[model samples]
Target: MSGDARGLWVTFEGGDGSGKTTQAELLRAWCEDEGHRVVRTREPGGTDVGQTIRELVLHHRGDIGPRAEALLFAADRSHHVAALVAPALARGEVVIQDRYLDSSVAYQGAARSLGAEEVRELSLWATGGALPDVTVLLDLDPVAARARLDADDKPFDRLEAEKSDFHARVRDAYLALADADPERFLVLDATASAEDLAARIRERVAPLL
Candidate 1:
């Protein structure tokens, strides 16, 4: 990548209702306020085609096998990386992806029994090895996360409605990723107040800027 390529790539990751989205938005707004160019996007739906795939992957109640779901997510990532994510990064925009390859590795690999290495290989291939420079994982208890989701009135999607055990495994995978790459992954507790959490994110990201 060129020295002047789009801004640093940061990704938010965690189990559902772990405040990744909330923190991502806060970070994006803060960056914009600081006069930094920022691009906020998400995997499986950063582009039109990817959005279609996202609908199928998240909202659809159909029973898709583990491998099938993995492939579909990969397909969405391919399009998202090529058409949306990569281009933004190339332009030197700070790209904030809501969820990226880590989500796939944790959900499909750890939770669904696909194997983490296999998921990593697929993600590298799909995104052309476009790993995020900084990954912030909002660590939260699985039960707490599900309770937060349940409190919302929106209909739970297929993945959202998964059992607590599955989410616990997913959380473990996230922790493993952070442990495996301490230099790149920043694991933060999710039980903190939103403002405090956002302040932590700002502190962690400010030095990178």
Candidate 2:
């Protein structure tokens, strides 16, 4: 890792069942094996306060407006950064987060009909303008992604139960984010096998490694 950059912050993002967690773990292991200090965490719950917000955001059955959800995610993100992210980065560790600000932009902003640019601005404010060094977005077909979720044993959360069209919009938003930031966004095709997906991510991380 470059000393000047301090630490490399990487985030994995995607819709439900997009294999982000598995891939994040794989990358973390790889980074550690290469002797880089690593800190693995997740958004919506990287800290105690964030986890509380996660439960409400993920499972709450009552109606929540787009702006409200976006702010909640931002609140969780702010706590996550204060409690974990910034300190890890200052120490020069490789910090891999399962999800992050991009999730709010895609799900709440694009999927829920809020504007994408506004969501990005909110994310900047929430995180104190800190952005990931790189973001890996698992680009999966909405139908296949939903099917994978159905096969999982975990109960579906409110967001998971959303209609296909909603998820499709979210997926589009993710792609748009990648397109807007080619230097730091890696779009992995979700159709790839796990092994292939990992390899693709390795390729993307090679420069930083």
Candidate 3:
């Protein structure tokens, strides 16, 4: 691992059921295997405070306005960074995170028709401009992703239950974000085998370690 006092931070992002969690776990395990301290977490629920917010944002059966939804996610992120993310990094542990700031940018800003830049700016401000060293984006077809989610026999969360059109917009927004920051993102096709995707991600991360 690099000798920097702060640990390397990596984020996994994608649309619903696009395998962000799977990829994040793989990276976490790999970092552990390599003898680096690994701290694994996910946005919207990375901290105890974030858990309450996560339930409200993702499962509450009510209409949340676009602006309100965006702010809720940002609020969770702010708490997450202060309570979990920043401390882990300061300890020099590799922080593997699922669904970071880009998620709010894609889901709320793009999919919900709020301005993408404004939402991103809100997140940046919340985190004091903290960005992952690498962002792995799993690009999957919305239909196929939905099918994968269905096979799990788990009820979809509010975002997952959204119409395919909304998911498509979220997908496009993620791709755009990756394209705009090619140096910081590794965009991968989600249809690839999980093993293959994990290997590719590990390969990309090896240099940093």
Clashing pairs for predicted structure model 2, backbone only: none
Query: What local distance difference test score does each model get?
Result: 0.88, 0.88, 0.90
Residue 32 of model 1, lDDT score: 94
lDDT string, candidate 1, 1-209, tens digits: 22445568899999999988889999999999999889899987888998899899888876899999999999888788788777887777888889988999999999999999998899889867777878999999999998898788788888888898999999999999999999889899999999999998889889877
Pitting candidate 1 against candidate 2, the one with the higher TM-score is: 1
Error of 1 at 70 (Å): 0.4
**Candidate 1 residue pairs in backbone clash:** 5-92, 6-91, 6-92, 6-93, 7-92, 7-93
Backbone collisions counted per model: 6, 0, 0
Question: What C-alpha lDDT, on a 0 to 100 scale, does residue 202 get in candidate 2?
Answer: 85
* lDDT ranking, high to low: 3, 1, 2
Please provide TM-scores, in order, for all candidate models, with all chains considered together.
0.96, 0.95, 0.96
Model 2 ranges with Cα > 4 A deviation:
1-4
- What ranges in model 1 sit over 4 Å off? 1-6
> What C-alpha lDDT does candidate 2 achieve relative to the native structure?
0.88
